[model samples]
Target: MFQKILIANRGEIALRVLRACKELGIQTVVVHSTADADAMHVRLADESVCIGPPPSRDSYLNIHQIVAACEITGADAVHPGYGFLSENAKFADILAAHNITFIGPSGDHIRIMGDKIEAKRTAKRLGIPVVPGSDGAVTDEKEAKRIAGEIGYPVIIKASAGGGGRGMKVALTEEDLEIALQTARSEAGAAFGDDAVYIEKYLQKPRHIEVQVFGDGFGRGVHFGERDCSLQRRHQKVWEEANSPALNAEERSRIGGICARAIADLGYSGAGTIEFLYENGEFYFIEMNTRLQVEHPVTEAITGIDLVHEQIRVASGGGLSVKQEDIKFNGHAIECRINAEDPRTFTPSPGTITHFHTPGGLGIRVDSGVYSGYKIPPYYDSLIGKLIVHGRNRVECMMRLRRALDEFVVDGIKTTLPLFRDLVGNADIANGDYDIHWLEKYLAKEE
Candidate 1:
């Protein structure tokens, strides 16, 4: 076991890792930007270091500074919680060269899975189900058109190196494919510094469900089951729930076994998510998240497992403690990401939180890093905390979430609490019939 670990993240996730480390008897050092000197994670961590100023590239994304902080703090391992450099293969390699463990998948796996096209090839080789798509990046308009023709019309063009819906465009019919390809390539180049784009058959009104998988270094793995993250806005997940009401018994057996086999085939290690877009009873592989997801707490609520501790133990050369047969999915869990943003315009509202409160009860859990006096910084991500609720079933879960979202509050700045209040109370959400586009159209109708 590592005596100390450095948390290379900010906001609530940083605090989440810190608390987990404390419970596992591992001291944690937090790396923060100059703007986050007074951040809550810094205060709660055993040690804190200022990496750089406000900009992410010079600070949180600065690989050398994070490495230096670990060296100075005697942190033998670094946990890249969710974002920033968490999925960067080079960052993992850098840590490895320094003899410091990265508490996730190995660098080789990261490199292979980081690229969408390459990951598809890997999945293709392993007999894992993948959506029909281009061979790889389409370098010429002719290649793009040829692939589009073969895949049929209305294909989705995506950046090979992108996530979070940054560089994506849908081309309906052949006439639109050329413009969509050029635009998507430009966006990808500008956003990710890679002009490479891939094409895939797009699923209409798909439910984004992902299987939570954990693997030890020895090719043994198990899945904790799936979470429906279809409650999303602009390709970013706002709410997530486990034991998706849409999945049946046979579907559960199929997806769970497939996810486990996929992880084992990749020789993956630590905690990673196998994301799939399900529509009309067909589940197609979308992508994989190479680190702990922000929605992990919901999985924990259902499975009653400490994923953070599991990640630590696995990184320390420990084999998986649980097997596929031993894992059982139970109950239902829901998570609402309480962000510091406007509910109407979806803009950042960075300021002091004057009055802050989170809900608590038998099945409610709040993961947060801010207090009433804490200032929400403009330079970082808007996520403030995650409000999670667990129940015996989906009906009970929705009711619990309704009450929890009502009780949760924040003042002195705009918040999505109002948006959530309306969402939780909606009949469609309560009835479990909402799709990916349902919220956007519903909110548009209100406007």
Candidate 2:
């Protein structure tokens, strides 16, 4: 185990890693921007360092600053708690060359999986089912149109190197494809510094499902099951649940095995997620997240596993602690990303939080890095906390989430609480018939 570790990110996830470190008898160091000087994670960590100014580029995304903090603190490992530089392969590469262990997949794995086109090809070669589409990146509108014709209409053009729903355009006709090509290429280039874009058959109402995988460097790996992130807005996941209501025994085993095999083929190590789009009982590999996901808590709630501890152990060159037979999921768990934003319009509402009261009780957990009097600066992501709940079943889980959301009180700054209140209580979501587009259409009708 690492004698000490530096967390290279902020917010609830940074705090999450801190707690795990404490439990493992490891010292914790936090790196925050000037704006987060008073953030809860900074206050709670045994040591804290300011990386840069309020802007993320100079702060959270500044690899040198983060590495410098680690060097100064005499830390042996770094835990990138999602977003920002978590999936940035170059950052991981620098950490490797500096001899500071990055507590995630190797930079090579991240680099390959970071490119959507390369990832798809890897998945295809590994025999993991991928959505039928173009052979590679489309360099021209004519090529895209040609591929779309063969793959049928309603194809989607996606950035070949990034996610979070950016640089995505849906074309249902040849004319639409021609118009979308240039714009998508431009957006893709701007977002990821790569002008490459690829076409894939877009499922009209697919459910987003992902299998969580953990591998120790010794070639041993096991899965922690699936997260149903079907409840999304604008392609970003808002809430996630474990042991998806959509998956069955046969399907789960098939997907899990295929995903494990895919990562194993790459000699993947540490924690990662294989995300897929499921529609009409078919699973198509979408992409792989080469780090711990934000919503991993819900999986922990259901399975009673500490993923961060596992990551650290793996990074320390320990084999997987749990076998395949030891894995089990019970009841249901849901996590709502409590962000400082207007529910209706989804705009950043950064301000001082006058009051903060988190829900606590059986089956409820709150992971956050803000508190009363904390200022939510407009310098980063709007997410302030994660409100997760577990129950004996889906119905109980839904009801518990409602009560938890009600009990969660953040007096200042607009939060997605209102949107969640209106969402989980809705008949369609509660009944589990909602697909990936459910939240979008639900919000649209509210107007």
Candidate 3:
């Protein structure tokens, strides 16, 4: 086991990793930007280092500074808690070269899965289903048009190296394809520095389902079922739930087994999520997240597994602690991403939190790094925390989530709490009758 681990990110996820390290008797070194001088993670870590200024490029994303911090702190491993350098293959290689383990997959795996185009090819090769469209990146207008026509129109153009809804455009007909391709490529080049784009058959209404998978690098793996992140806005997940209400036990088992086998076959290590677009009894691969997801709490709640703890152990060369058949799914769980943003406009809200009150009781958990009087800086993500609730079933889980959301309180800044409150009360959300487009449509109606 690593004596000390450096957390290479901030906010709730950094705090989350810190706690896990503490539980496993591992000391922690938290690196923070000047903007986060008084952040909760820094306060709670065994040691803290100020890396740079507020801008992410100068601070969180500065690889040299982070590596220096690790060397200075004598930290043997780095747990990049999502975002920033979490999926950077170069960062992983740098850490390995310095004799520090990255508590995730190898740089090779990250490289393969980080590229959207290559990820699709790898998924298809691994016997995982993928969307029907172009075999690879399409550059010329003629080839783009040909693929769009073969896919029967309504095709989506996506950046080969993009995420979070950027560099993506949908064309309902052939007339829209040209403009859509141009816009998508432009956005791709601007956002990712890569003009490469691919075409995929666009599904009208598909649920965003992702299977939580873990591997031990020694060809052993297991799955903790699926999380339904269908409730999204601008491609960002707003709400997530475990054991997707849209899928039955059989479907869940089938998909989970497939993901687990794939991870084992690829010899992947640590935590990874295989995301898919599910519709009408079919699942088309979307992309794979090479790190822990923000919505992982819901899966942990249902599976009785401490994923962070497992991640640390596996990265330390300890094989999987639990076998595939030994893992059990227990209950329904829901997670609401409580962000510091206007519920209506979705604008970022950054200010001092005058009051912070979290909900408690059986089946309710709030994972946050903020407190009363904590100033939410404008330099980083506006997420305040995550509110996760678990119950015996979906109905019970919904009731518990509603009660918990009411109990959650934050002041001195706008938050999306109101949005979640309204969503939990809606008939569609209550019945889980929603798809990837449901949240946008609901927000449009509100407008």
Candidate 4:
């Protein structure tokens, strides 16, 4: 086991990794930007170092400063808690060259899965199902049009290196394909410095189902289950639930086994998610996240597995402790990504939190990094915390989620709490009758 681990991020995820390290009796070093001098993770870390000023590029995203922090603190391993450098293959390679461990998959695996185009090819080669689409990057307008024609109309153009809904456009007909391709390429070049884009047969009502997978880097792996992150806005997941309400035991088992086998075949270590778009009776691969997801708590809540601890163990050369058959899924879990934003307008809300309260009960868990007087800086992501609830079944889980939401409170800044309150009571959300596009349509109606 590592004696000390450096956390290379901030906010709730940083705090989450810190707590996990503490539980395993490992000392922790937390790096923070000047804007996060008083951040919760820094305050609670065994040791803290100020990396640089905020605006992430100079601070949280600076690789050299992070390496210096690790060297200064004698941190043998780094747990990048999502975002920033988590998926940077070069960062992982650099750490390894310095004799420091990155508590996730290898740089090779990260490189293969980070690019959407390559990931699709790898997924297909691994026997995973994928949507019918172009074999590789559609470079020219002619190639884009040809793929769209073959796939039928209503194709989607996506950046080969894109995420967060950027560099993506949908064309309902052949006439719209040109504009969609041009816009997607332009956005791709601007956002990712890569003008490569691909085409896929767009599914109208697919549910965003992602399987949670873990590996030991020794050709061994296991899958917990699936999470339904269908409730999204602008391609961002707002709410997520484990054991997707849309899938049954047979479907879940089938996809989960496929993902577990794929990860094992790749010799992947630590936590990763194989995301898919599920519609009717088929599951089509969308992409793969090479690090722990923002919505991991829901999966932890259902499986009773401490993923962070497992990540640390596997990265430290310890093989997987639980076998696939030994792992059991117990209950339904839901996670609400509580962000500092206007519920109605979806604008960023950055300010001091004057009053703060969190709900606590048998099935409710809140992971937050803010206090009453904490200042939410605008330089970083708007997320403040996550509220996860678990219950014996879906019905019980929703009821518990509703009760917990009523008790969550934050003041002196706008938040999306009200939005969750409404979602919990809506007939569609209540019955799990929602897709990736459902929230966008619902929000449009309200506007």
Q: Look at candidate 3 and tell me the lDDT of residue 196.
A: 96
Off by over 4 Å in 1: none
Q: Judged by TM-score relative to the true structure, which candidate is superior, 1 or 4?
A: 4
lDDT of each: 0.89, 0.89, 0.95, 0.95
The TM-score obtained by model 4 is 0.99
Residue-level lDDT for 207 in candidate 3: 99
**C-alpha positional error of residue 8 in candidate 2 after TM-score superposition, expressed in Å:** 0.5
Estimate candidate 1's alpha-carbon lDDT, on a 0 to 1 scale: 0.89
Model 1: per-residue Cα lDDT at residue 174: 88
RMSD of each: 1.1, 1.1, 0.6, 0.6
Q: How many residue pairs clash in each candidate at the backbone level?
A: 0, 0, 0, 0
Cα lDDT tens digits for candidate 4, 1-447 = 999999999999999999999999999999999999999999999999999998888998899999999999999999999999999999999999999999999999999999999999999999899999999999888888888889898999999999999999999998899999999999999999998999999999999999999999889989999999999999999999998999999999999999999999988899999999999999999999999999999989988999999999999998887999989999899999999999999899999999999999999999999999999999999999999999999999999999999999999999999999999999999899999999999999999
If scored against the real structure, what TM-score would every candidate get? 0.98, 0.98, 0.99, 0.99
The digit string of per-residue lDDT tens for model 2 on 316-376 reads: 8886788878988888999999999998899999999999999989999999889899989
Task: Please give, for residues 1-447, the per-residue lDDT of candidate 1 as tens digits.
Answer: 999999999999999989999999999899999889998889988899999999999999999999999889899999999999999999999999999999999888988889999988887786668888887888888998899889887899999999888789999988998899899999999999998999999777888889999889787878989988998888889988888878998998899888888788777899999888898898888788889999999999988888999999999897687888877777899998988899988899999999999888879999999999888889888999889999999889888988998888898989888988998888898988877777778878988
Which residue ranges in model 4 land beyond 4 Å of their true spot? none
Candidate 3 wrongly placed segments (more than 4 Å): none
How far residue 322's Cα lies from its native spot in candidate 3, in Å, is: 0.5
